[model samples]
Target: MSAIVNRLAPANAVVPEQQPSAVAGLRLETRIVDGAEWDRTIAGFDEVCQEQLHVFATARWPSVKQEPMLFLADGQVVGGSLMMVQPLPLRIGHIAVSKWGPMLKDSSAPHAAALRDAMVEALIADYAERRGLMLSVLPRAALETDNSAYERLLARGFKRGSELGFPSRYIVRLGLSDAEQRKSLQQKWRYHLNKSEKAGLSFEHAGPERMGEFDRLYAAMSERKQFPDHSAYDTVPLLMALDIETLRPELFFVRHAGEVVAGALIFKAGDRAVYLYGATNDTALPLRAGYFMHWQIIRWLRDNTRAGWYDLGGTDGFHGLHQFKKGMVGEAGVITPVPPVANYAARPWAYLLGNGAFWARDAAYHIRRVVTGALRPKARPDQAPVVVEAGQP
Candidate 1:
């Protein structure tokens, strides 16, 4: 199997200047940022995904070298990204990847589009041309009527890449009033929530100390359904224990008869909150605890984080999970992120080889997941599969 990466630019497209280049009055530069500095810088952005956070990078790629780059205008920060770089064999070059960035300070401003282009161009100048690295970016643009960000990447000689596994997410706008939020729920979903409320189920915003309870429920559900446990169990505790108050991940649980039956781990950064992982046992399914758990988390986000959006994460081709998420956010909330696009930089041949290796490895992983899932034994008639959202690194 060949590892595939995003496609490269047309062989004839002229590469931009390799040095620091100003675009639309924005100057791009790199900085040596500690955890506090990284957190403080990203706090001002309007949209920040968990992948861009320092804790996430530390936990997901502890051994990889990370670079923090910022886009400044008039000596003020306007955009930034946290990039993780892995050196290719024998110093041929490095493969640099940025997920859900470079995030802009104000994406709704009149000059926001131009600012975004400048950020992308600067990345190209520094990583691709000057450093001769293969840079792949998952730009933080939604699948919306406005696609200028996607277009800009292509215009700048980036090659389109595969989804790398996840293609889309369902994001619900959280700025709505409580009444409006409920109104947005699909009719059947609303009904389930109503029923769960009458079922004597108790929802709590739990702390990291209750992780033991969550682990037990998750393990029980996994065994009952005979499915692989892909939850971020190892990293959840670390995120939950972060010293930063606003940046810490939240753990929520739903209990029936004083026993925990379901749990969810959510991570928030900037104005966005993402559903990282979830699990429910048979006891929870009957009570519709999943719906109730998510609702409580949504309300908590509204009151505490003031986050503007909630991402339900990827559904992993599970029909039940897709239907479940669609009921909460509706079809309109579904969004496919821009696929990772790569710039070959100065060493086009090196980029091609590195991306090829990545593509092959990703393809093989999905194939194995499909095979393993199919071979799992059927669950008991009364049991339902645990709801696990596919999380990104």
Candidate 2:
């Protein structure tokens, strides 16, 4: 962690000086990155989220570790990814998770897919060599809706998809007017927001200093809600550790009668803002603090964050949280879960376990999807097969 890293090019420079590869026209190098190196790698990439940044990956938390990686084409940083490593019960190796990334400096290149494949291949090989046997990844892509990355994973022989896993998703694209946004929401949602606005609720924003407030309310909210004990670490510490002045979190609190009633915490990286976590008290519920918090959060992203999208994060199968997130949409877009990709390490134990379990997982998920698709009606007249949208990263 103390090693000095080689710096990449300037922020404004987009092109990488290229040369021939050993494999003819294919030319890219993938390398594991350390602290400073990871910083530079992410800085060079075009899109990212706080979760994909190195600080979030390398948080000092129980059962979590980070492996930052980068892809280079002709010696210029072109792609970056963060793998969250956690030990698998009954297994000797770690399970690596890459969420929302392997972001490229430019995913719009003429030969982007080819470059992506080559770069990903190198990354997979590196993971097998240095880390564990199984890598579980959900590209920072929209599930069900976009599948370009999904197809690419299949091409590389990685098993994909999930059943009863990977939460359903919702997202809001910023830059829309307040009225236009409200018009997009479900009827009841719009009513809630309008009601919440007149309910005498005020908003407050904060950073890490207010984490304790977040923690206390979150605990009370969890107890009241009775969610499964969080199986993961609190992300506040991760965000706290980062040099995130530019991408600082906007922690919004709903105050009524000068009392903190509800809260939402949003995180950013590159140009994306994700509603990381939030909680509401019973008092805040009738006041519709959640609705007001989201509205204020969206406005903050549009103005202060310089971000383009607001990821409402995931929704439970339970209708309560799902309905609340849907209300926030106004007219914003939604993103479903992206398919998960699995690549095994070549080691004997890794190969045997990965080959058997990974393929089986993929088969089960695929079968379920096929059955559901058949039962569901088509969105368009000529739609036939399960086709993925083209050109997404």
| Reference-based TM-score of each model | 0.83, 0.76
Give a tens-digit lDDT track for model 2, residues 1-393: 643333332231222223222234455655566766676557534566666666655553446777676767787666777767766446555656667666766765656655665656655655665554566666665523556665566655566544334345667778777777777677898888889999999988876788788788888987775544433336577566556365456677889997889987777655567777787777998898888888888877787765667877655343566567656654456645545554545466765665565556568766755564466423111322222232111
Clashes found in each candidate (C-alpha, N, C closer than 3 A):
7, 5
Determine the C-alpha RMSD for candidate 2 after optimal superposition of all C-alphas: 8.0
lDDT per residue for candidate 1 within 224-253, as digits (tens), equals 878666555676776777777666778898
Off by over 4 Å in 2: 1-24, 40-44, 60-65, 84-97, 107-112, 128-132, 161-166, 231-233, 344-349, 355-393
CA lDDT for candidate 1: 0.69
Overall local distance difference test of candidate 2: 0.63
Superposition TM-score, candidate 1 onto the true structure:
0.83
Candidate that scores best on TM-score: 1
Residue runs of model 1 more than 4 Å from their true location after superposition = 1-23, 89-92, 141-143, 164-166, 337-340, 377-393
Residue range with the least summed lDDT across 10 consecutive positions in model 1: 1-10
lDDT values for all models? 0.69, 0.63
